[model samples]
Target: MSLRSYFLSSAILMGAAGIIGASGPLQAKAHAAEVSGQPQPLPLPPALPTARDVSYGGTITLNVNATDLQRHILTMQETIPLPPDVSEKGGDFILLYPMWLPGDHSPTGTLDQLAGLKISAGGKQIPWVRDTVTVSAFHVQVPKGTHQLDVSYQLLTPVSPKEGRVVMTDAMVNVQWSAVSLYPAGYFTRQIQFKPQVVFPAGWSYGTALRSDGAQSGHTVTFKTVSFNTLVDSPIFSGKYFKKFDLTQDDKVPVTLNVMADRPEDLAATDDQIKAHRELVHQANLLFGSHHYDHYDFLLALTDKLGGIGLEHHQSSENSGPRGYFTKWDKTFAARDLLAHEFTHSWNGKYRRPADLWAANFNTPQRGSGLWVYEGQTQYWGYVLAARAGLMTAPQVEDALAEVAAVYDGRQGRMWRPLIDTTNDPVIAQRAPQSWRSWSRSEDYYSEGQLIWLDADTLIRKLSDNKKSLNDFADTFFATNNGSFVTSTYQFDDVVKALNAVQPYDWATFLHQRVQDIRDHAPLDGFSRTGARLTFTEKPSDYIESYSTLRHVTDFLFSLGFAVGKKGVISEVLWGSPAWQAGITRDQELVAVNGEVYDADDLKDAITAAKAKSAAPITLLLRDGDSFHTVSITYHGGLRYPHLEGKMDGLGAILSPLSGKISVTDHKE
Candidate 1:
């Protein structure tokens, strides 16, 4: 049967009870009743990637004064050499700041941060003009016989205490290279060579994939020759409080954890915790079967002060989290896959990149068409790798899996938009403010991709009689011959080719239907095929609890289909939910609940009151934009959270073996 038919059949088996929950008292539910639920490493790659590096033959000096980070500014002076071709190309030269950055996959270059923009050749200041149509490009006419130009500017660092600010504390800084430099506009980015040098605050140490020339003169440091690709790909994480731990002892792949935090105490990780992380490398190596880089760096920033962000690179990733990220192990483990996921990108997004995303120049806007496979597949293996390494418990992974299933199932936007189209969200949304996130689904590919891959894995197991699986597909697709810095681009057909090589099917059509076509239900056939099913629970999921605690919000997302902020404000009105039908929306504050003053407690009391009383419409007085209005919502579902249940049938036989198969008991904490 097709993926659609499979879900309809499975939905009956899974959601067989009814479309909506009954208005009864909240109670305990049994764990997946379908079937008995069973349930890295170092490498150092070379200094330079094997890409075309056109030598302009000069160093760009970037001076940063991070000592007083409260000012949120980084001053810089970039000296660029005018290539001989400048004269031949008519001197109307354009210097482009990084616009379309890789990994970010957006035109994220902060043009507004640029100040004191001045260019000089032969000690004479040259007039520069900003392009009308192109925002990032700067036009400057070169003087006669001038082989070099000096450019000076300043950058305003972002300060976001909770959001993972790019600029952390006064002592630590995450240097995004693209933010500080300007490149020539004519050649391919790989063909552009740079001798990068930076001058920072005194006494601050740094860690980056960029090979420092050991030519540190006081606070200033210079790096060896490398292509612009490597220069930008290598992010610098440096600070006052830093700790280095080698994850691998003596392996072909060298892995190291370079952690920086606001406090020294936060850098502490137990021996067991370190061992589990070390096993992460081993597990990944075992899964992929081939290594890409010679060495890897986990640039972890542990701080409550810094804005938390996770962006993947070939050799390194910016894994920023709370102060208790490592200190509070189990609680923070839900997001443990942040490091693993970004690491997987080294293979998926860096080595075997999408054809359209792997552009020639930094200014080229990346066509985010393959984010499903690029980000989606990486997300799948990230959780697997973490679990295999004992970063999370099997039950924790299951809880996390339930969140994915529930997220897709509740994603009412799927009725309007297909999964594939949202791949362009990196450019369009790219972190846009959540206006109507549930109504306008954002990046469903990651969760949906996991579901799709699970289905594919289930299909493979059934076809090959459990002799093969997605692991086989991963081993074939990711691993390359000999460790090299070379990148391989792939198309849609390449994904299907790898899958068919393991087990032949009409995968292209299946994938097209699942990803391109809009459907009412989520791609839950994977659960059914794996001898499992999705079901509802009265309690909140571990994933939900962890996130809710961190964010400090009352999420009745699965229950009433809405989330209330700390100040009795309705943050979102989920699509097709009770609140949506009642005409309740975002920014509306709840003034009263059933004639009582509205607050988190009062809201809960009202919902609980509904459960015990008649499944009556809960009356709520909302403060709309200008006027206050009363909304009556009919929501019988008291408090429902989704979890995966077992089928225990023929498919369950195959699914039970795969559950937590990647996890090793030796590393169990």
Candidate 2:
């Protein structure tokens, strides 16, 4: 019977049956009770008070004891003064831990690590409740005649990498104020004052942007009063082995490089290393033509124990390097550009912020629509400045760019997701590992955005006959309000305006096409405009070699479409590649290749042999979970890695240092 006729007949029979059954009262009640229960959503509780642009009326005193190295606990005591109005009529008061952290570009506050939270007023403990909607907020009823409240908490710093970032180690400690302090609600963070102090382990020197109030008494040090915003931005990096090097240029604003290491010998920096860092400062000034902070500090930690960081701030940056950063400078070229990347943020991200990214308080959500300019342009200048400062050779930077180009070009996710949308990955993915990273792109804006800026730079040079470049844009956009660290927020229109002022063009349409539109291919016009071509070769570039050595991975990305780490574990598998076509995945063990024990060199040999013998498939034994299987990959492509070939005059010009004299002042703090 036809589906329609069958349903119609069934409905008629059911209706007839219902009529016959409804003759009895019990049957009629049973037929009426056929409806399923549906529940409505309950109303959410009221939101916490919104921050107002007004003063908090009193300075908050925050004391942190960070000497617990064994347990990695930061004991915090905060004294908050109550406003006169709040003291007279006690009502609901709210305190917030930082949620939307600056530079993280997401709500990544370590609220889970907060423990033993207690609040008291007038020497008596007061009850508090956490806000249901915003867990970061604490709601409390203030008692009448209460002038102040004493808050105490302990931050359980992660001891292992699996838990979270290890901020405290036996020899060093990184104290981020946002993790250990609470601010009152209903006032702008900039309008709330804070008097901060920290007690560290004995004989451990510290580096921070916060100016010291006086001489340290034993292990305790107090800093001058600053707004809560600045307090959070200025973090402390203290260690037993510490050294400070001055990279100040022309004796103008002071720029210091503070180094902390795992051992005392790791602080041994050669004269040339120091000169390169000084040149980094000089090149940055030559590019932006201004300085934002009165004094800037580069808090560099050279250790393998502390959690790695490259976070930027207005006056200082938190950075990490290998234990052999200065001791083995030749092998550390892959990480040389970290300082440049963070330093550029002083102008791009801190001084000139995205309009939607600026928040009035720590609890406010920040939109990442402008991170393409905030982080992307910074990435562009990072490599450029690294080359210009002699930290990395021009060829090395070119090789680095070649790798970036290859990765984005091979990214299949671009067919569906645009570069602009990846800006949301910080919140969407929180940087968690993905099963198909190449297919599901994660934060392509950093490198892909770098390519976009390169496109703009080369286009500007071509239009202006090499008379103007992105340097002019930087000078016009970021150099404003020199010596002032006050944030200047900008929107999309401002970026386009600045670029047009540098070189007349339809920047809005250009940016829209590259950023907003999803395309199958990455933007490679920048390399072509510079007379360079991205090509694959059997030999890996020096940069790629260093990368593999540093990361402890073997790359067959272009051939087998996967990278193998130690013990023959597949770290990544490119989507739609031969390995992927064979149903291979990441985290799987390549137990054997072509009936032989799995080895990086052996696999390369197998791929090469397969290239010569087209009919012979590369057999692989893989282990997934508890299951083991064998598969044959019919890929004939030999080992291939990306490299740049042809003239790179335009790129060379972009990386060459501007003619200037660098004067350095050596000092120890």
Candidate 3:
């Protein structure tokens, strides 16, 4: 029978019971039948249900009242109809209440402390197996048909400190027995044991990252996966939603969005976000054959406290963040860009499950040495898509690239390590914290790896007509590898092979040379420079200070053998000495030296070099008010340069004496 037929059949068995005490008086009803004479009629006790019997091809039902205070409960009295071929074999049925809810990252692992787990079958309490991890089980004769397993337990709500200010908008709450129960059964590599029907706070709408399978009076979200094993790991979410965007393609592949928001602004932003995301997904679909699922949904929630987080599954993507995060320019741009990043995972994580990801044991450590490609390559697409979608302009894209470049260039870590190590060693891949020196062995896979991808993208564009770009390779990668599952997982070598299969150049040699060994940086210089340029102009102000003190120092140190200004810029030409010899400079503008900027640090590197090696020459690029000129001077060691000495002390102690001076003020105590 079809799922609808099953649901209809089950709904008939459930009958149309008026939702007791939905918005009315709460009272106790007893279930005691009859009593002796002269006594009042006994009240009927509340109904409770429990699971019993596991025999194949059996049907069972139990009458029970689910607990809900404000709203009526739409109890689905349905059985998990296993495939006909699989026999009723015994195995551990695991159940787990995710420590972290969808889009929430707070430490909620303690929620397993539930109170009074009781199961009743036919007005009689039944003994079931219990586990230490807050799970229960029932051993019974295997039955086929439909089985009504009723489980009732009390959930203690956590009182948050930021309650009034915090809000969870567009939230999709899904509760499932099989999900919570992490049980393994037969040959079925169960992803999640029980997927609870959602129980959200009444009046709050649902926005989930899971598809909604149409059901009677409610929605049923069926998970679609190439492999049953892949499907099992991806969880399902269900709840009421604020806004729903149905992107179902002519009834074949379905797409829907469940949107929630804390404020009206959030809804407005989400609307815009959804519109942009639709186009992006459309673009991604061009590469992959067809979305694996019939319908796709985004469980999007805008929360005041919940920061940005996206956990992608097969059919749905869960995204949550602050309400204003998607409205402000910088924050919104970043948030939307991140959403795209997660969206790309539909291909990388969902379609092409990493070899390490095949049997992803969330309980154990996940080792993905190729995260540089997995996460890093995917990260590269976030900004690319954002720009291509018009959310970010080409200039903004260049600026973002500049930021990444500057970060990579300034980092002390990259100097000592190669990016490929992250792909080679699982320890470095997982980012295990080592000693300060050892910790510097790995750099950000996303930043540098993205640069690599960007560089490759430039090369691809230059090598091939813009007609054949990374998009083509992306399409080819997905088409050739989509849904291959276990036997044909894509690896680093597979990616290179794919690129080389259609490329005009030696891709592996290029990857090894540029990615493995550092070369002239600006691999995307042609694209970036053409895309954006910064115009710097000096602005004069009346509040500028004079360099009289520096001149005075120069004059005083004349006997020490340092010319005040010789060359146009600061230049320390002495080798092995303070200035060139000592590594000091002549006329280099002392913008900032030794962790102190020009304002706080009186002496610059050029001046320090001059003082340290009095007999050396140095260059300085000075910008005092409207004056911008290069100056160089010669130095001969002797009298200690007070500015240099004090500056050195500050650098050593991380405290500049000039800036560290304390003020005397009136104090009470």
Candidate 4:
């Protein structure tokens, strides 16, 4: 409103009050008493909202005005692209303006749930079809051309844990614009046209969708040309901000760091980070092809509390937390490692992408067969590229490799299942309350995948006399499969073909047999065990539990009577087996089987045969704690030992025994 209009309204209201005051108290009272029935004063006029101008297939504007705490007005105007099939068949389109939270991955909020709706098109008062308990999906039937559309509604901003409304109070809003209706499918989109222009209360800037319109002036700017695919992936943050380093290299992409925090020194840390990250990027570019982006920006968002998150994108990655490594670790080294891992994503997971996700749609599942390559190869390079670029020392890489190797060797159950299977499985077997814990115990895809890549790379290098490495194959794969938004259909096949072409060897069979199948024991024992040098082996000083005595007795029993069930759960006491031979019955719950209990300490002992046993017959006890009796179990024979040998560091070691004394160079052919 203008200053003149404000003055005029103020003067009218004051003049009316003065006229009433001028009427004396006695005269006013007499007049009120005489006027028994009179018409009420007319209500003030309602506020009018401004209409937005939209161009292209994405001209949706929402003016959500919440000047008061009770009533809010949400005005929407959108222009969406109709599919060719829909346009041909005269398909009806339903444009929905569903309410959603900023961080919520799914739009299932109750704010948009309504009993009725009122809608109009081009100022025509048309009857809006409504559904009970749902805000109607505005059904619009239009020809296949960009047309100006407008929608406006008044809604109540429901009170929430994050303080009433996310957008109004926080001065931040995440707007989603898609071609498909957003009512039923949780706001997921296959195609979107443009990023919406955001208007915040003055003095706030966005955290995401780094403005293509330049620095926002006076709290309003139009984000003119944003593709729909990029809209869903981008989230915006508007609040207080601090500027970090703005890195500009001669031939490389510029790096901008926006540090939003309460502290000023938070921006100071970027001095070293900018330098270190630039060096790291330069090093990676030297190894891999150019990281093709105009510029790269990192948003270092520091919330009030400690935060641990790094979400990646083509041009930017969000890094938020407390002071973090910059405040805690050796600033130089830690920053280098952190930057290397995140920056590597620009090439691998971001550009190279999984073949299965070539035509990925947000609402649907796109399962790819190349987790082994995408995740595994990415893992391989994260460390390899760092080492090659001199960002990490050779020993540091080897140390990291050993840690990963040990983790893989320890968790063989992951190998039992493919990287895909475990990912698809439910956290709980039966949708029970405690199912989320299932993932905690499951095998890590990245860890196992990395081991596979290492093994594959090693074989490739050795088979071709170092003439053909995995890197060559990867470059070809990227060239062949780049620009794909869905999963790659021929990535794996093409990679295998390229490998065979260059080496002229049947490596696909090797990959399928060794890498694909769990049973194929693609041995890593030959990969040098520098354990004695790199790791410590401190044997127990006193009486450590004895496995030798129990192994012999258990081996004898396995030969005689007991049977092992799937997953190593000892199932039955055989009819004439040693367990049965020792007077064990059908319902006997063995507490201490051969002096080993069903606990971690005892379980490891059972595997190692560390629990001591009687020289002759063994007295096994069954118990529901204190209420059970002893079942006499006599040992007869032995447990089968699955043993295999492989050469490493010019020396041989038994794989099953996992002896730490194996040579480190036995595998180098």
Error of 1 at 579 (Å): 0.9
Q: Count the backbone clashes (under 3 Å) in each candidate.
A: 26, 0, 122, 32
Q: Is candidate 3 or candidate 4 better by TM-score?
A: 4
Model 3 residue runs over 4 Å out of place are 1-181, 185-196, 209-241, 246-253, 269-275, 286-290, 325-331, 360-365, 416-443, 465-467, 481-488, 512-669
- Per-model lDDT: 0.76, 0.90, 0.43, 0.43
lDDT per residue as tens, model 1, 49-79 = 2223455445444544445567767777777
Better of 1 and 4 by TM-score: 1
lDDT of 4 by residue, 1-669 (tens): 332344356567765664556567855764675596644343242221121222223334433322332232233333334444445554234444433321122233344523234434455533333222234344444334423334444444334424333232332232223211232212234334553555554565555544545635555656645554465445444444455466545453566655565454554564454565555555555444345345666555554332234545556665554443344323223223434555565666666665554443333334445555655566666666555545454444554554455434533343355454533322222112221121232324455666666666666666777676666665555434332333224566676787776566776776665455654233353243312221212121011111212111122222334433223333344344455556544333446656666342343344334223634445555653357666654442333222212323211111111112212221210
Q: Of 3 and 4, which scores higher on lDDT? A: 4
Please report how far candidate 3 places residue 178 from its true position, in Å. Answer: 9.1
Name the weakest run of 10 consecutive residues (lDDT summed) in model 2: 660-669
Weakest 10 consecutive residues of candidate 4 by summed lDDT = 650-659
Candidate with the greatest lDDT versus the true structure? 2
RMSD of each: 18.0, 9.6, 22.1, 19.8
Q: How close is candidate 1 to the true structure, as a TM-score?
A: 0.86
Sort the candidates on TM-score, descending order. 2, 1, 4, 3
Tell me model 2's lDDT, rounded to 2 decimals.
0.90
The reply for model 4, stretches above 4 Å from the true place, is: 1-58, 61-91, 95-192, 200-210, 214-217, 237-239, 270-272, 302-308, 331-339, 385-398, 423-443, 464-468, 479-490, 501-505, 513-515, 519-669
